[model samples]
Target: MHIHKLPDDVLHGILQHSCYFQYPDFYKWKRLLLLLSICKRWRHLAIPLVYNRVYLSYYDQSEDTSIVDDEPVETIKGAKTKTNLDLFVINNCASLARYADIRILFTSNAFKGLNQTIERMKSVLKTWSGIKTLSLTLVNDVYFVEHQVTAELYDAAQINQLTKELYNLIPGILNLRLKGSRLDRTNKHLYGKLAGYYNNQLKQLSSRHAIGLSDNIYFAQISKLDILLNSENGYKLSQMCTTSLVHLNIRGVPVNYRWASFKTNNDVEQIVFPHLKTFNISYLSSTPSVDRTGTELYNNGRLKIHFPVLTKLHLWSPLGHCELLASAIFPEKMDTFDVLGSSKTMQVLSNMRIPQVKKLYLNVASTTSNIRHATLQLINKILENSPGSKKNKLIIHEDSIQIDPAVIEWSQLTLLHIGAQINMDIALKVIAKLPNVDELTFYNFVAENIPEEAFALKNTSGCHNKLEALNSSITKLMLGHNELGHSKDAVITVIKYLSVRLESLSLFGAQVAFDTDMSEFVNDYSHIYPNLTNVTFRLLTAKVL
Candidate 1:
């Protein structure tokens, strides 16, 4: 059936699932282009979704850059007719924007022709249609254009000029997101001035300044707020626009009013955020600082907090232990719900009536046996609580823990990547415990006494039995971690272990078997891994040695 014939939600889901409106290169845009040519109804739906946002990245030369699409052999709205931007789309996927992100990253560099850029930019902006909101997420000093992405920090004056240029060119509303900055730490006015310049259209902001205070009127009606640095005026800023907030991220210890604190004068019906989508919070403490009053209020269910549209809630406490209090209400369906930490996080994960998490990551690092037991308990709990167990991609860091298969249902595990020396005995022992993992990626491997074969092809007697437990299940293997100065024997040894079963192998992290030609290496080892079809790598230079 034609996807457009489905209901709005269903059809939208199909387009999203197929990534029709995605960057098109490394995507299904050609089908979208075909639909645009033939299907009028499809065009009606797709035009809005396709050109909703334009990611024009000119990496090499931000100046003298009349951006051209390396793919999509057609032009749009005569904007592509002009020399500078006769075709207003570029094709490369440095990152992928999800369904809701209608962001067109056009900053610093204007789309000027080989001769005059500013006039060409205005002309393109004038012709381009259906782009109602131009949102930018400026995280760090990086801007993407064409095949290359470069980083060069800008000062106050430069920022002001760029803002003015964009504001002047595009007729639609401009919403800027200051996620991170490349501004010098000493330079104070740049963030404030840039934020304050277009505060009206700002929807999401990550700021450390004392916004919404008497000193500065830096509130741009932002709905998603990230408090990066703990400012003194954080309390007032969070309280300023409680009505329109869709997301709030608190990056420090959630103790005071700076931490999603929606309290009133004893109002039981005061639901803080009626339509918040996500709430990501982290703490730098093992013991989360909750005062006496806060605990008392939460215990009685007096503090009302509601998330009707929440899809994700990622809270990680890497520094120390963490414990989530009896929180408020959440919808039945959540895309990703992660609450990760050292020890306490594991306890919470194991005991709680867990939600249907789409992606679960567990990092348990402890040398003690009790913690290891708790880690295994958490793993078992995760498998039991989560629905559609296969779709749930579970990752746990068991650096020191030994998985005693008899105690737990280790057979339920399908994919395991323990954060430790990949070639070491512990990692193999754990992988050996989970016999169903179909794919594996190992990094930072030690060139110790790696067995010629992890598990004997004919069933051997010692640790060999545990090493290649994934031989039948594992088809794809990615070996990362650059031991650039080390010998290629590490790579050869590990590959030799899985050589019989592996169909594809990829090397990343700047070391390609000490710069040895992988084609020749594969050919030389052709007799071993007869099924190996593809091999890829990134060869590093001798300077890195």
Candidate 2:
């Protein structure tokens, strides 16, 4: 039936339904071809829709032949046996390559018909002019012989030439991921060429290159860059700039320049990212060649130099350099500052001018009882440093690590996280002052930690009722590493008001209850919060028990 013959309204509905999802297969094309075989009018309606999507795969295998009788022998060198798999894909999918996308992969037979295979891929890429996405993947290993004198060398030369040609064809590609170790040499040269053809609108570029001492691939064009490099040559590529780049993350160790260290000032040479909004950096420890201790050493490269528009900074560094880093990036007006590991640097870190920083995460462990002094210093510094009246968060490692309440002005601090142990009066007063306080987390809990007064107040004045009076936004809570003891009644009473507004609750424990009835409790609470998405209960029990 001709689509034009249908009523105009009916045709519009058909077109809308057809446009719902991008059909990336040749089913539409095959249907059109069948319609053409039927009659002229049907063919006209199907042809235009058929032209929308083209899918193609090319292989060298003959349709009639089976590998059961003749398996190509693996060779170190020679004519280079090729499998029939490559032939099958190519011959079958050749016509479909023009409409949707073109995907190419090497078969065991690729070596046997190297020249023909290269011609086929080049043809597929060229003929598919309408294609927007193209994928080239290396599935299996291809062996090459280092023959003293043979035609095999000539074939190897052809393969290299073909690889170079393919490299030049890839810059126009939108999403690209190149895997395998053998292709590194070809890829490095390819990356150098691609740096020139960078698209300003490029979305994702993930490249895993050899860990060496040189900066070869340019990340200046990629908006989202994920690089896994060998530790030895990791941080050497700091010069490239994509000023418009919004998110930046580097994962690798620093290549120390020790001999020239003190003699020259190691400040960042140029600011590459002025529009950067979020930044995360961590060292890759799994690379076999890297010395764990060596990578931890302080280097000028550890400091973040290119951040003015940054709003969130998530950093994981050891205890020592935390303060030094905070001082270096003091100019950034961050909304969130998260530091991981023992926060020995808190005293120095909190002193830096971070008036714009509202959420400060001191996610760290302390061995000494001196935590109170350090916490006080950090709070005092934060109050003195920040310019204005913005509420903030101060998450101490645990509640037992006593902090002087007077050092921090609870009036301006909206959120608090600490160890489970708390003085009932102090806790209530602190909760009262932060009217906007929304989220609270208690780490390392114990049942004995809850005072008798809290239980009595829950029954009498309903302290849980006062908690209910707090702003509705105060809906999420995390109690990590649970230590619930004998008092289930008291615990349940305290949680009543909080659970009413709570959207999420996470519990981690060795033994939550002697009764093993927590699952029943969780299922009952699941229906209470209308907006609740998840409730997690993680029990840590010994295998023997």
RMSD after CA superposition, every candidate: 10.5, 10.0
The TM-score that candidate 1 achieves is 0.54
Candidate 2 lDDT tens digits, 1-545: 86557865576456446533443443343434444344565445544444444433333343213223444422222222232223324435433332223322333433334334445445445443333344333322233212212432323354446545544543345544434343334334333333324334345544455322233344445566544444333334433345545765655533231111111234433233566777765533232343333222234445344466778777655432352354245344678776654445566566556636767655544423565446655565655566453656666664556544544454555566776455334444445555555556555433444444344433433222332333424444554434344466644534443343333333222333433334544444434443323544333333211
| Model 1 / residue 121 / CA error / Å | 16
Show how many residue pairs clash in every candidate, following the order shown: 10, 22
Note the residue pairs that clash in candidate 1.
57-144, 57-145, 57-146, 58-145, 59-145, 80-86, 80-87, 81-86, 112-117, 286-321
Worst 10 residues of 2 by lDDT: 255-264
| Error of model 1, residue 307, in angstroms | 2.1
lDDT of 1 at 469: 25
Relative to the true structure, candidate 2 reaches a TM of 0.54
User: What TM-score would each prediction reach against the true structure?
Assistant: 0.54, 0.54
lDDT of 1 by residue, 113-145 (tens): 111233444555443323334433332223332
- What is residue 276's positional error in candidate 1, in angstroms? 2.1
